[model samples]
Structure formats: C-alpha cells, structure tokens
Target chain A: AQTVTQSQPEMSVQEAETVTLSCTYDTSESDYYLFWYKQPPSRQMILVIRQEAYKQQNATENRFSVNFQKAAKSFSLKISDSQLGDAAMYFCAYNANNAGNMLTFGGGTRLMVKP
Target chain B: DVKVTQSSRYLVKRTGEKVFLECVQDMDHENMFWYRQDPGLGLRLIYFSYDVKMKEKGDIPEGYSVSREKKERFSLILESASTNQTSMYLCASRYPGPYNEQFFGPGTRLTVL
Candidate 1:
C-alpha cells in the first residue's frame, strides 16, 4: 500500500510571495505519478500540478510547480507570486502504475494567502 | 472540458435512512470514483468503477455500496446511514490511462443526524 504524508497541516504565505508545501510518500514501485490538488472553500477541487516519476524535470503550471525527488520519495509543491485565489486546501496524491488509477492522498495542507 | 457533477450539493438525513448519491460525467470516461472528504483527512476513496456494471472497493468501503449501470454515471449508496457517515462526498472521473488527471465534482455535503 502506498501512503502520502503532508507533515504541515497549515501554511500561510503573503500575497506575491513564494511558498512551498512539503509532501512525502512511501511506495516501492518505480513507475508512479504524483499530483497536487487545490480545493477552495465551497468550491470544486482542481488539479494544481502533476509530476511523473520517470521525468526528472519538475512540472509547472503558471505559478504552481513541483519539486519531485524520486530517490527521497518526496514531492513538494511551490507557489510563486501567490495570489489570494491560492488560498485553499492542498492535497498531495500518489498513484502507482499498477494501482488501477486509484490515488492515495495525504492529510492535506490548508494554504492561506495573506494580503 | 471534462465535467463531473454530483446529484446534490447538500443533503440531510436521519440515522437508519437510506441515502443515495449520484454522480454523472459528460466525457464518457471509463473510470469513475467515489471519495469521502473530512477535515484533516484529505480524501479517502470509498469505491470506484472501471467500466459499466463494474465496481471495486477502495480503501474505505465499509458501510458503502456503489452501482455503475452505465459508463457515465456512478451511484453511491448507504443502506443505513449513520452519524459517522456524515461528510463531504466527492465524485471524480478520468480516462483509463497513466497520465490523465481525474476531474472532480463540486461535492455533496451530507449530514446524518
């Protein structure tokens, strides 16, 4: 079984600043996927970024990027030029290649972007 | 754009009542999933379906049953609702592939009193 852990329960960042949310997972499979999802209050959950284990380069989408360290089993999300809209609950998820698309998620980190 | 929609955004029911949560996807995705979300606990999979009429138990399937009579719709049922079952239920769907991301619904917040 794969387990994702987000040690930080909550994180705060000033608007226009940068913030990094930590995530770690336990999985024996070499082929897997990692993702970060964001859910705002009373809003739908949306994908923030994703990283493929085989890809050494991190994934980035606008202000969101991931620091994927396969050897350390760590995948962290970094938000640059953070905006108020970035304030949401962020989740780190793992899905092994053979896991049939079922994702194991971490406890989640609540991000607060202060103005 | 892919869209996953749940039947209701909010629901209230009493203990022992039968509860049904419906999920529909417009993209004709072969995979659908049901998950429960609670504070401090990101999201726990309850059930998932890979195809029509095929359902699989997830990490926490206890007290929950699912039906997937069609490829685009998946239903989650609580035969006897309990207070412990009160939580935000989320529905997601994705294509059967390694790199595709799952699309999520707005979620249904159920309260069992």
Candidate 2:
C-alpha cells in the first residue's frame, strides 16, 4: 500500500511570487508516476504537473514544476510567478505502473494567493 | 477534448432513500471510476468498472454499488442513504492502459439528511 503525505495543510504566497508545496510518499515500486492536481472552489480537479520516478530531471509545465527526489521519496510542487488563480487545494498523487490503475492521493494543501 | 458528465451538480436526499448518481463519458473510455471526496480525506475510490457489467470494489465500497449497463455510462447507487454518505462524488474515465490520464467530471455534491 502506497501513501502520499502533504505535511502543510495551508500555504500562502504573494502575487507574482513563488511557492512550494511539500509532498512525500512511501512506495516500494521502482517505477511509478507522481502527479500534482489542483482543485479550485469549483471542485474540479485539474492536472498541474507530472514526474516519472525513473527520470532524474524534474518536470516543468508553464509556471508549475516538480522537485522529484526519488531517493528521499519526496516530490514537491513549485509554482513560480504565482497568480490569484493559483489559489486552490493542491494534492500530490502516486500511481504505480500496474493493472490497478488506481491513484493514491495526499491529504492536500490549500494554497492562498495574496494581492 | 475528453468530457465526463455527471447527472447532477447537487442532490439532496433523506435517510434510507435510494439514491442513484449517473455518469457518462464522451471519449469512449473503457475504464470508469467513482470517488468520494471529504473535507480532510482527499479522495477515496468507491467503485470502478473496466467494461460493461464488469465492476470492481475500490478502497471504500461499504454502502455503495455501481452499474455499468453501457460502456459510456456508469451509475453509482446507494441502497440506503445515510448521513455519513454525504459528500462530493466525482466520476472519471480513462483508457484501458497504464500511465493514462483519467478525465474527471464536474462532480455532484450529495447531501443526505
């Protein structure tokens, strides 16, 4: 059983600044996928970024990037040039390359952007 | 663009009443999933279907049942609605392979009183 943990329950960042949300997971599988999802007040979950465990380089998408440390079992999401629209509940998810196709999600970190 | 649609955005039901939540996908995905989201619990899978009439129990399937009569549509049923079952229900669909992204619906917020 894989478990993802987001230690920070709430995080706030000023507009145009940068913010980082921490995430850690426990998994024995060598190859897996890590994902960061954002949920606004609308309750719609949207994909932010993804990182493959096998890849040594971090993944970057627009202003969203991930600091993936496979050895430390840490995958953190970094949002650069944060905007008001970035305010939401961010979740870290883990999925193994198997038949289950089920995603294990972290508790979530609520991000707030201050103008 | 993949689109998953849930039947209702919000629903209210009484205790012991039978409740049915419907979901439909337009991408012709072979896998559909039902999940419940609580305040602090993130999201928990309730049920999933790989094919028509082929359903599997997820992590939490105690008071929930599902039906996939057709490939595009999947339905979740609460035989006896309880107050504890009130939460935001989400429906998602994806292809039948590993590492594929699952498309999600807008979600239905159910309230059992």
Leading candidate by TM-score? 1
Tell me the chain A TM-score of model 2. 0.97
- All candidates' TM-scores? 0.98, 0.97
- Tens digits of per-residue lDDT, candidate 2, A1-115, equal 8889999999999999999999999988998998998999886787888888889999999999889999999999999999999999998888898736688889889999999
How displaced is residue B109 in candidate 1, in Å? 0.6
In model 1, the runs with Cα more than 4 Å from the true position are: none
The model with the greatest lDDT is 1
Model 1, residue B83: what's the lDDT? Answer: 100
In candidate 2, which residue pairs get closer than 3 Å at backbone N, Cα or C atoms, i.e. clash? none
Q: After superposition, how far is residue B31 of candidate 2 from its true place, in Å?
A: 1.0
Looking at candidate 2 chain A, the ten consecutive residues that score lowest on lDDT are A96-105
lDDT of 1 by residue, A48-105 (tens): 8998899999999988898999999999999999999999999999989888778999
**A50: Cα error in model 2, Å:** 1.1
